[model samples]
Target: MPYIPTRYFCLIAALVTLAIAVSARFATNDYFFFAGYVVLQYVVMATAWNILGGYTGYVNFGTAGFFAIGAYSAVVMHKLFEPPLVVSIAVGGVMSGLVGLGMGYLTLRLRGVFFAIATLALAIVLQTLITNWDFVGGSRGVYIIRPANGPFGHPYIQYLFLTMLVLSTIAVCIARAIEHSKLGYGLATIRDDELAAEAAGVPTLKLKLIATVLSGALMGMAGAPLPYYVTYLDPSSGFNLAFAVNSIAMPLIGGTSSWLGPVIGALLLATIQQIATVTISSALNLLIVGVIMVGFVVAAPNGIVGLFERGVRARRRPAKKEAA
Candidate 1:
């Protein structure tokens, strides 16, 4: 298609966010806001994961580790001295980004399955640490009290939904900006072949580190609101395998090649999961996600975006032949 300016994209995102906020005001049931919040959270997580896993060609299985860092960071803040939610969110992002940088420095040298294994190990290590830390409630978990009154007198859940909506927009816009930037090109080279990229003087390691930091920060920000949303957080919930699974699955299902893919994938999958949770049993949510992901892996390895791109190219081939 055509190259659209980032400013124009931001404007569109703002308008869409406004529309969602307005719609929430009219909704009678609070469940819509609750469910919407979760969907938007996945949108942020999936987009974040795509920065490294999709764009940089490094699959990170430690999504839950970074996510829990964000959540527990908030917990610590609340217990000591409750700061504004924004502050906790910012701190969470920074902590996760730092960890990402360290992880990249240590393991980016290892490619393929080895790197993936390292990240999964990182998650296992974090979970073990959190499980034993008594101050954060150890294995028992902790409870958080949501502020009784939210901004503008709206329900706290609505506020969270709006926060997540804005965050998802920011994440998408940032991803799109990177996709069109020099850094993105450098990262793409690394994705294609790190050795070749290094030989080509592409600064492969630096680019990969940047991708990891940005990806981790976004994931942490996505998790920062979890404490408030759930009102209770334990190692089990914070380190849930679902976060890692969904983060990888959504981008793959939507099409990882472009910034829009994860958003599309997250919206479709998360919404479906939400409906299934309500209609069927919540226990079946992961099963449903697994089944859908398997189908996509079998039939559309490149994802929905790839399928559409393929069709476009196919049509263009016939047109060029006719012209000749």
Candidate 2:
């Protein structure tokens, strides 16, 4: 047998931890299960946003566009074909990816705030269109009447928790792959200097499009089951600013340089919000996130990961001096 690296061991340990957590949720009450599901969903969406916003330095304000597309996709599939839950999620992801690719192709030419504004405009337009569309429920909303018993039993929370868990895991894997691949380097170059990156033979437009498609697909997956979870879907709720803000804020606060950044930020922020909701108004959660985002931007622009790295280096300094 060959020796496994410490990193591989750590990875195995993390997977085990995740499995244990999922099992624990099954043994817990519905409220705990739902809370876990929401946090995991946030992790998925935030990680998806990080692909473009963090890696490519593109502030996409149209995450809600993909999210809405996904919810609608799921609703349409469930209403028309009566597909399985997994199929609905897949449909949402595919539809959102196609839309994202198109939007990327159109707006990748724009730079800085212009690109951001273009995405925001796209989101607004999509919201309006959905609001008028009645097939999947117009401005009123769509109600998803879940089955009493399915593959996962009568407990909706368990199924939602598992679904979100899988989605979040997939989101993390995709982010890690991009961060460690040539695409990641290209994105970093594009982020740092698009003109220089283009001069260096990086296909800026293609890379941006790929990133957008992937980001949108993952976001769509996160949103696909949302209608079932809430038992209702409305244009206003589906295309909310909180989705965009949380997706961006998590990466920024966690340290966008690595895949772990958005994951860490999402977990921390979601946990905080969940706890606060018990004692304070749920509406104040956004206020908390906004305050933290502003503070992080001014105090620790690199985020929690950056701070951790600095602390690690500081600890190692004394050991290096002793060895010398």
Candidate 3:
């Protein structure tokens, strides 16, 4: 594949977004917007998780913690001052980024399962704190009243969908930029072997920290719209394990090696899950995720992208052999 310029990519993305917006404008069902918003939210999140977990091989299980921090931060803003969604989103990203930095500093020294465990512990600790903090609704939860009409005068759900779509685009562009840059190479080295990377003066810790901060901030931004989307926030729902599970699963199921993987995975899985939620039952959502993920793990361990790449390579080999 030829290397495409970021500007060109952005232009293409803009066109695609405009097309989607036009389609949504004609959409008769508000459910379309609601479902699309969730899928796009996962796109942002899975991409964010891939930054640290896939790129840096950190495997953070504290996704829920960072996500809740963003939601709760938005809730606080709503209660105290009621800033615009954009401001709330920015604040949420900053808060989560700071937490990610702190968490990375404290736990980045540990490697492998130890690091993973530490992240799980971090989520648990944060959830416990949030449960006890009554100001943000504590164990009871809080309600957010969304405006009926959005800034553009469409229904608020459509606005949320558009917001998430833009965010997902930004996340993908960021991921692609990182993947093609020196930072990506540095993180890849750390992912492959942190000790070796450190010995070779790769600044493994710094790179990992950067990945963590980026990942957490993106996750937070993705979560910032949750209050408006759900209209209710609680410790239980805010810190749901499904967020962490799906974030990890989507990247793995799609292929962790590239930016496209998470997007593909999130779109496929979230869409399937949404369909299942409507047709079957919401209770079966996790079960569906587990079944599909297991099938992918067993059959295409490298993920759908990897499977496709392998097929392409196999087909190319015959042509090369014939040429020889």
Candidate 4:
């Protein structure tokens, strides 16, 4: 069969997804909608995180900080003057993108673990600041009342799921576009060796800033909807380290090399975690992720994608020998 055009594939996928989201309301219960929303939210988070972490080789432990910035920004907006979800999400993205840009300006030059440490410090700082900001309830947290009438006629949770699905689609589109662009080549060079990339005129700092802003913005957008989903926002929950851990783990375990890796990783890891949470205990979810991450790192260092590529090449070698 002829290769399908990327745009056509993406368009068809989006339409199919829209169909599912609409049909899902009739077919599935609210619990599935709620759970699916969580999974899709991580799909956006993992994809966004990988733009910087996987592409540029800068591992950010501040995923929670950017995510909370989005959530808290929404809370502040709601209290001051409630806006629609889309508007609030945009505001959140801007807030987190600015933070990322500032952080990149100061610390992007610090290579490797040092840069990661800086991001960790930033997360801690943001968490502390939010904990003291009483307007948004600070450590006490704030409660959000979802609008009785959602954008469409559907229940609010279902609407939230659809919104996440759209956001996840948008994020994946951006990542795939970037992966196939010259920018991706620059990022790969930087990831492999910043010195060589810089020597080759890759505009290292500028590229890093772009990756940081895009990654943080997408992360913020993902977190923006959480206020409606959770109904309560606290620094403790908003700044939970699980965001950082899972975002990092999902991308790593899926394969950090391409756009689809994070999505695959998120779906697999999230589905398994969801199952474990139901049959096992919710507390064991993170432990399972940890064990799986360690195993992937040791056994398949390049992730599921790497293993897949290896398998394909292994099969190809036998075919080549037969042809010869």
Measured by lDDT, the strongest candidate is 3
CA lDDT of each candidate? 0.92, 0.87, 0.93, 0.91
Each prediction's TM-score against the native? 0.98, 0.93, 0.98, 0.97
Encode model 4's per-residue lDDT on 151-208: one tens digit a residue: 8887888889899999999899889878877999998999999889989999999999
Q: After superposition, how far is residue 260 of candidate 2 from its true place, in Å?
A: 0.5
Q: lDDT winner between 1 and 4, please give it.
A: 1
Off by over 4 Å in 1: none
Q: Candidate 3's residue-wise lDDT over 90-119, tens digit each?
A: 999999999999999999999989999999
**lDDT measured at residue 320 in model 3 versus the true structure, 0 to 100:** 100
- Candidate 2 residue 92 Cα shift, in angstroms, is 0.5
lDDT value for candidate 1?
A: 0.92
Which scores greater on TM-score, model 3 or model 4?
3
lDDT of 1 by residue, 244-280 (tens): 9999999999999989899999999999999999998
Sliding window of 10 residues with minimal summed lDDT for model 4: 1-10
Off by over 4 Å in 2: 1-14, 318-324
Model 4 whole-model lDDT (C-alpha atoms): 0.91
